[model samples]
Target: MQWIEIVVLALIQGLTEFLPVSSSAHLLLVPLFTDWPDQGLAFDIAVHFGSLLAVIFYFRDDLIKLTRAWVGSIVGSGMNQEARLGWAIIWATVPVGIAGLLAKGIIETSMRSGYFMGYSLIMFGLLLGYADWRYQRKFSANPASANSDEYHLSKTQIAVIGFSQALALIPGTSRSGITITAALLMGVNREASARFSFLLSIPVIVLATMLQSVELVAEPLPVGWGKLLAATAISALSAYLCIRVFLALIRRIGMQPFVLYRLLLGAYLLYCFY
Candidate 1:
């Protein structure tokens, strides 16, 4: 791949990976817009692997606590808040894992059409907007309402959010967007929802990378490793920056901007595709 192509695709993958915007949508649209060659599954895996690193490093401290707590709970040690939270992340990832496995073939073929992207973008975007609106109203009525001790998600609520994440299997549905929308719909505070969405991404991304790694192993070797490494580094940096800025903005802005952006993007896709 060319330098510019590598840079643009890497940045796009990294930047949108954490955002409510769907990175898969952006990637699929790239060739449509620019007529670039298929970056291939190997490149996709590399860039996503970079994003995994970004999330891991960004949440290193939290991961340590969660890991320790989770391990403790496994050996009959008393489960604490962190341990329970750890388990919550695990449970939340299961639905998507299974869905992705069952639907992977169909998703990569028939589901790749722009028609699917347009509808999913608009539908899920509206859902996200509604959730944010409701969240704002509740927050206005009772400041720190979501912060109340009783506001944490129950098991049923977690299950609901987990199942909703499977919707992100569609190209434009956006894993983070769907998960955050689920959190907001369940009355989770914006910051907390964003945090949980990011946490939930760990296992999902790891699983995706593992699957792609198997494919990468079977493909040609040593041909593009240098370019792949460079792209991975770029993706990591971009993802890290996006996570930091998104967390900061989400706390204050409450996702209105993203909702608007999604609506506009969805509309454009509909016009272009249909």
Candidate 2:
């Protein structure tokens, strides 16, 4: 890939990764539209690592507390604030982890097909729109108590959210978008849902990136080190900014705008494909 392509891909990866717009969809579409060379598994892993760093940096303090709490909880110590939250996160991750392992081959095949990609974009975009609308109604009808524990995600809720996350195995069905939708549907406050969704992403992304990196080392891509470094830097910088902007936006306006954007983008992709 040229320097320009690297920059563009990195920017897109960073921005969409957290924006509730599917990063996988954008990664596939951007290259298709721009005629850039295939961004092989190595580049994909590198960009994901960039985003992983952005999230870790953004939530450094929270992570430290959560890790300590989780370790304590594992040893049968009394649960603390961070431990409770950490357990909730682990509970949420279980379903996705199992599902991803079982369906890896099927998911890979679907991602390789443009038709499945277009269909998923349109379908999930509509799902997000409906979810946003429904969540608005729930919040307006009965707002959550201020004193309610923000870290609490019931076992059922975690399972439901995890099931929703499995949908993200589809190319255009974003992990963030689907998880947020599930949380909203389960009566989680929009801001809280988005926050949790982001937190939940760290483990999955890190594991996936590491595995992909190993694969890349075993069978190197055609690209060089220069291209890889440039892509990683661009992805990290843009991802940091995108996380900041997205968190602010969710606070201010909820997820409706992102839902609308997803819908429109999905429609355009469908139109092009059809």
Index of the highest-TM-score prediction:
1
User: Best lDDT goes to which candidate?
Assistant: 1
Model 2 Cα lDDT, one tens digit per residue, 1-274 = 6788788888999888988888877776774577767777878887888898888899899999999989998888879878888988877788788888898898887565556666777777777778777877766676663223338777778789878887787788899999988887777777788778889899889768877777777884475878888888888889989888877877568777876787777777777666
Could you tell me which residue pairs clash in candidate 1? none
TM values, all candidates: 0.96, 0.93
Candidate lDDT values, in order: 0.88, 0.80
Segments of candidate 1 deviating more than 4 angstroms:
148-151
Write down the TM-score for model 1. Answer: 0.96
Error of 2 at 215 (Å): 1.5
Query: Per-residue alpha-carbon lDDT of model 1 for 1-274, expressed as tens digits?
Result: 8999999999999999999978877876787779788888888888998999999999999999989999999998898888888889888889999999999999989888877898888889999999999999999999867782212567976898899999889889999999899888888888888888998999999998998888888987665889999999999999999999998888778888888988888888888889
* Stretch of 10 with least lDDT, candidate 1: 144-153
Clashes of each: 0, 0
